[model samples]
Target: MSDGGDEGDDAESDDASAGTTHALRPLRTDLAPVVEAVEATGADAFVAVGDRFDDDLRYLTRFSGPDRPYALVVVPDGASGDDRENGADVGRAVCCAPALFDEQARREFVAGARARGDGEDDDPGDGEDPGDETNAHDGVAREVRTENVGDHAGERAAAAVAELVDGSDTDHTLLVPSSVPHDAAVYLERAGNELSSTDAVTAARARKTDAELDRLRRAQRATAAGMARAETVLADGEAGEDEAGRPVLRWEGAPLTTERLRREVNAALAARGVRDAGNTVIGAGPSAADLHYVGDEPVRPGETVLLDISPRGPDGYYGDMTRTFVVDGDGGWERRAYVAVESARETALAEVEPGVPAKTVHGEAAAELAAYGFDPNAGEGETGFTHGTGHGVGVSLHESPSLTGAGELRPGHVVTVEPGVYGPDVGGVRLEDLVVVTDDGYEILAEYPFGIVPEKRG
Candidate 1:
């Protein structure tokens, strides 16, 4: 188990009166990294379409709403007519959203643009003075321009992109991130701009900033509280009998069904202002043997219940964690499986750090599970350690630098080290924790106990 130490304070920010309000700090998106990534791909510009649902768009522009109503283009800045000649590495991001959200986007854009260490009224005196570098290329918000595309969001966005491509003296090819919708990609292609994968953007997002890490930590704390509530329910659960006189677990004198447990867990998360992104798995017994199973049977004593919750915080970041428990403290095969899973989890976590291959971490966990007398590489139909070791978590539940033991781990990267062993006869045991990759080591963000059974509440 990792140390549950205080990482820092929770991040909270004022909303810009849009469809959704972010309680976390403004996204500190530096275009320099994106520009460099795009430049390396030999593309003159990079475009991201869709609304906040697309994490890439939200990460860069924070434009989220029920309706996807925006497209963003990043280009290099240059003097009036000869921008291509300037060939500056810095980028100027232009956001095109529907007029409906124009005012809100404007407010958000300006607020995010404020330079650090400078007051709101800090000015460079006169325009001719060139001494004020605050408006320099590094300032993402100031260099950003938002345009309103009357009604047709995608078509208008394509038109705006066409204009940008035609105006630029450089290559008209624009790189679109994988998250962009097919229709949006078609629009860009039809507009005469060639499109390619925005792999670099994905790589850039894998590394979180200080502010992003803070939001993730806060989200995980809320998740841990929700987990604690689940534990309390389990701890208070009494041994009982179902209609067939079979053994079961009951809470508050009611039989605890998987659906009931799911509702309660979601309610707990909701109480903390977190929205259930729908992947809240509360599986029991045989159903628990199958990964991603949405259990519906009544939870029974002496059986393991796997709880995996990935909730979206008010700030749009996600907190992913999982824990397996046996109600009423059954000390049989379930507990043994839990211990093995925890060992594998710790082993994998120790391998997390900068410059290490992500697959190496997964391999370590698999090895630990194998040493525990379980098969880490069972056949397709067999029950063993199933699924990947872990995955990167951020605005999207599963992002980049996957922990299949392949990608290179880097500082700012946040991932879960979840290891599990599932079987039809013994059920399953899985544990997960969110952690941030550090320069020298890793820090656990999900600050909660790793016990399989919950202590009785006072």
Candidate 2:
């Protein structure tokens, strides 16, 4: 966990506005690595198109535009005569945004690139400076430019892609991500461009930069606040009866339910400048065993309530965490499952280091669960460890370098180490923590207590 200091202070300060607060650190998105990967594919240009839901496109361009298609095109630096004369090794990055989003895109993508001096010159152009409009030919891209295309985002983006590789004498081959929209692919192909799919962007996103790590840490802390709010409510709750005179946990003069707890958690998250993105999973009683449950079942005094909240921050980064809580407990199967899951979480986290195979982490967690008399390979509907150990978390809630994937852990990789045990008999127990693989080991983003009994926070 991060030591309480400037980082902690910055995370708690809600004074900064959305989007602007996280810009304190410049993004270290070097396109050099991407260029190398693209070159290996023998593609004349790379193009990606999507609306706001496209995390890969957002990572490539850093343009958080409205829910309409925008495009990012990358070509070899010297592919065009203009770039060759400029003497750039890195490729060119062009953002094709709708007219309504032109200025916003320029501010987010072009301005940031200029501030980082990723371009050829360091001078952040004054109105009169001729070099102010020059392309960034160094770090993130050889040059970053934006075009205010008309209404058709996909068509315009395709046209931009065609123009970017038009200089090639041979049939230009365009490399597109596997998730590219069918319409965009059709447009590119109809424009006489050959389309080939590549995973370069996904691979790049697996390893994050320092700025991303900072954003993730802030997000996780906010998530912890949300969890604390739910826990606080449960802690302060008192025994009561429901409409039918059944035992229930009541808070604020009402029976506590999953829906009520979820609202509390989401409100806390919003207060901290993050949105729940409708991913707040609060399951009580038998509903807890059904992962991703979002119903309004009453929470009782002795049943497990699984709280899996993965909220998205203002800067587009996600924070994922899961904790199970039981209010005044009898400590039956719930306690045993909690202990096993916690141990499995620790075992998985211990194996998170640079160069360790990602699958090894899952295997170790499974082994630990099995040692505790829980079968990791239990039948589909049977109780035991059900899901994989964890997954990579970033711009998208789920990304690459998965715990079950055949890739090795890298220093900059941020992933979730979650081990869960589910059973209909006593609900479900899950413990999850977000961690970043460091040079030698791993660092949990925030410090959150693990216990079946709810803990009150001041």
Model 2 poorest 10 in a row by lDDT: 3-12
Model 1 per-residue lDDT tens digits across residues 1-458: 24533343221111211133344444656766676666677777778888767778787765555275577777654333255345433556667756566555654543445454454334322223221223432533232334445544455655555565455333367777887888887766766677888676777788998778767876786677667667778888898998889999988878998888888778777766777778778888877777776768788888888888888875588888888888765587788788888888878888887889989999999999899888999754477787889898888898887898466898898998889998887578888888998888898885556677765421
In model 1, state the lDDT of residue 201: 71
lDDT of 1 at 80: 36
Give candidate 2 regions above 4 Å deviation.
1-23, 79-87, 115-154, 166-170
Position 266, candidate 1: lDDT: 82
Each candidate structure's TM-score, on Cα atoms with residue i matched to residue i, is 0.85, 0.89
What would the per-residue lDDT of candidate 2 be over residues 1-458, giving only the tens digit for each residue? 33211123223333322333433365535555566666888777788889888888888777776587877777765544466456544566777766667567666666655533343333433343222424553433422334545545556656666666664334568888899998888877766778888888899999988878878887888888888889999999999999999999999999999999999999888887889999999999888988789889999999998999999985699999999998878888899999899888878877888999999999999999999999897664579988888999989999987999998999989999889888876698999888899898888887677778887853
Q: Which structure among the candidates has the greatest lDDT?
A: 2
Scored by lDDT, model 2 comes in at 0.78
TM-score of 1: 0.85
RMSD of model 2 against the true structure: 4.2
How many residue pairs clash (N, CA or C atoms closer than 3 angstroms) in each of the candidate models, in the order given? 4, 3
